[model samples]
Target: PDTTVVVGPGGSFEVPLNPPLTNGETVTVIVTDPAGNSSTPVTVEAPDTTAPAPATDVQVAPDGSSVTGNAEPGATVGVDTDGDGQPDTTVVVGPGGNFEVPLNPPLTNGETVTVIVTDPAGNSSTPVTAEAPDFPDAPQVNASNGSVLSGTAEAGVTIVITDGNGNPIGQTSADANGSWSFTPGSQLPDGTVVNVVARDAAGNSSPATSITVDGVAPNAPVVEPSNGSELSGTAEPGSSVTLTDGNGNPIGQTTADANGNWSFTPSTPLPDGTVVNVVARDAAGNSSPPASVTVDAVAPATPTVDPSNGTTLSGTAEPGATVTLTDGNGNPIGQVTADGSGNWTFTPSTPLPNGTVVNATATDPSGNASSPASVTVDAVAPATPVVNPSNGTTLSGTAEPGATVTLTDGNGNPIGQVTADGSGNWSFTPTTPLPNGTVVNATATDASGNTSAGSSVTVD
Candidate 1:
């Protein structure tokens, strides 16, 4: 039954809907006079013309990074990444009613995946849901060579590799069905030890797996001196060398050239006949057997003499070396061998003339001869420069022009020395003032380095 309202004559009336009308229903109203006369009726329609389907059959990623579902074509799909009712991202569905939405941070495996489809008119469908997958097993990685390393792991997992010290070296991802491989940009050396780990889509990493590689070392190099004191050797082309002392301690290292030639010089000269240990190593850390050698290539000690004109000469040299004494003309005068104490002495055939140049040579047991050490003879002394007994510290007189004048105390300690001018006049002042009654001596030396008898004086 329809309800009716009556109003007082001479006015319009207002109607209020307390409960509101149902959607999609039509209503009609008619006006009549008190005499029971009916007027024309008016009709009105309610709002609501369209409905869009919400997303359905949603599939969530095992890692919870994204979700996929079917929605009305041309509709937008939104995902609630945080499991909250509100969507964090919205993506338009393809014409075929397919849609996919990604989440920056993957959701939990057991977390609910809420998704809704919004139509062009802003109408939203019922939300859909799908569960995430479970975590898979850790990956199994294999050993590697200098180049490629292959292994197997959970599908879509990332393989991370590091050196034994936990330094990152390389990384790769596994394909569907769990097969994976990694190839380093550079070649790895033999005997290189490394660790490998697997990272799942959820960012969970597996325990590290240790792997050791084997490599072959180059043949022991032939280490010899490069003409002098440098250590030179040959090894695998492009390899390197580590040098050690007799005690097998590292002393130096060097890389081989393209031709496998390497050389290294010590900061200081090594002692003669010293033993140095050496080994050849490659980039892979593989090393050849240590090769040992005695450093006997050094020259023998140069022969020397105490006095240039002495009838007998003595000096230290390599033990068991042959020492030969020769005149200025290169004629051998005498020969001797150094004793175990490295001491040697040689005497000329007779008293040698003054100004004679004597040279000595030493040949070590290895037949290496030393450079000639020479001394000139100074037999005839220069005329002693004149000095008065009361001259104090001043000493001056005449001798060979350009000769040296030496002043000394009675005890032979040199006071001073001066060279005569072209005119042969010379003088010297004592660095320490002379004391009265002190005895001083003076001598003169010619260009030949001949010293004259000492002339004495008592300081005034």
Candidate 2:
């Protein structure tokens, strides 16, 4: 028999052994305390050599909470969480039969963790699961910036904000006053690219909306021929024109001045006579389509002469005598006649004295007439002559050797003459410099009487 003792609150007592025990023999043991208390007789069938069945009711603490439990004395509490078939956490039960199985690791909200309690006996309990309440989903994000200018995005344009993951953050409508706003954090992260999908309450976003955040403006569009007024004149290659706004900010620049005008000849020239806009813009992004002008590429016609009238010259004329005239084109016209014995006469097929200009081509039929003779065929005398380098006027120019220069009055009469020195320089000591607005004729005659075409000089 196997003997054992039982102890009560009052005193200890002996256990009666029955049927002398033998190794591996089954036996029963009973014990009574002094207080007459007795433990239910324990059957000590030979030492329980067989392993104890696995523990029951083994479980991990509830999720998000902790747990405490008792384990077999001197046994290890093995926990297999996630059911991967491996022990994650373990706690050794001391001889005192106290043990604690902690949750494997902290779990996130909305996550579930399974825990299996295993004892040193190599037996495991069914897995116990704990779940964390789902956390609030990341706030939806929605936001977009836009413009209120002509291109699009007028005030009252709807703007939607979305989350970084493209989820709708919130629903917002614009106010009638053309403005709308949302409370911060009622949505997701601030300053994020809020994909503001805005639609007018009228369901009108067909054209789509543009956005400008935090007072930023959209990129300015490119404008051609920028801004300026129209110009008229012959514009040749290499010419440029100035372009500026009312405020004087250069927006478009083109070269035309070199060619007497500006040319915007496109790579593909605009169809002939095509009217186009010549726009100007300001630096502030303001534009002016109002100042546009039409383009006319056709040039003006050349002038023509119109004198077919007959005319006659009187008085003694030298062999080199010349007559001055004018054609319908305003070009100087001249004619000359033969002379013999210091006398000459010219009768034109067309009558003169009608303010026409003519040149007299008088020659000895040998040498060129001393500077082809030029004569004015007007009923009245020529306009008053205003000499340049007038009386006492200083002259600066290259003069030919032995050059004799003479200043003439309105009637081709000499006013003053100067003889060039050996250095080809000559100065007439005029009474005074020529007065402004005065017209005068000048003639340079070589020693051979060969005179140069008359030149007119006007004082500034």
Provide the global lDDT of candidate 1 against the true structure: 0.74
TM-score of each: 0.36, 0.26
* Highest-TM-score candidate: 1
Taken over the whole model, the C-alpha lDDT of each candidate is 0.74, 0.45
Clashes of each: 0, 63
Instruction: Give RMSD (Å) of candidate 1 vs. truth.
Output: 17.6
lDDT of 1 by residue, 59-174 (tens): 87766788887888987787776666888899988989888788776766466777878777667777777777654555676645557677788778888888877888898888
For candidate 2, what is the TM-score? 0.26
lDDT (Cα, 0-100) at 60 in candidate 2: 36
Candidate 2 per-residue lDDT over residues 96-201, each given as its tens digit: 7666666646555446544444555455555555554433222222123222211223355555555445776555555555445565443233234444455544
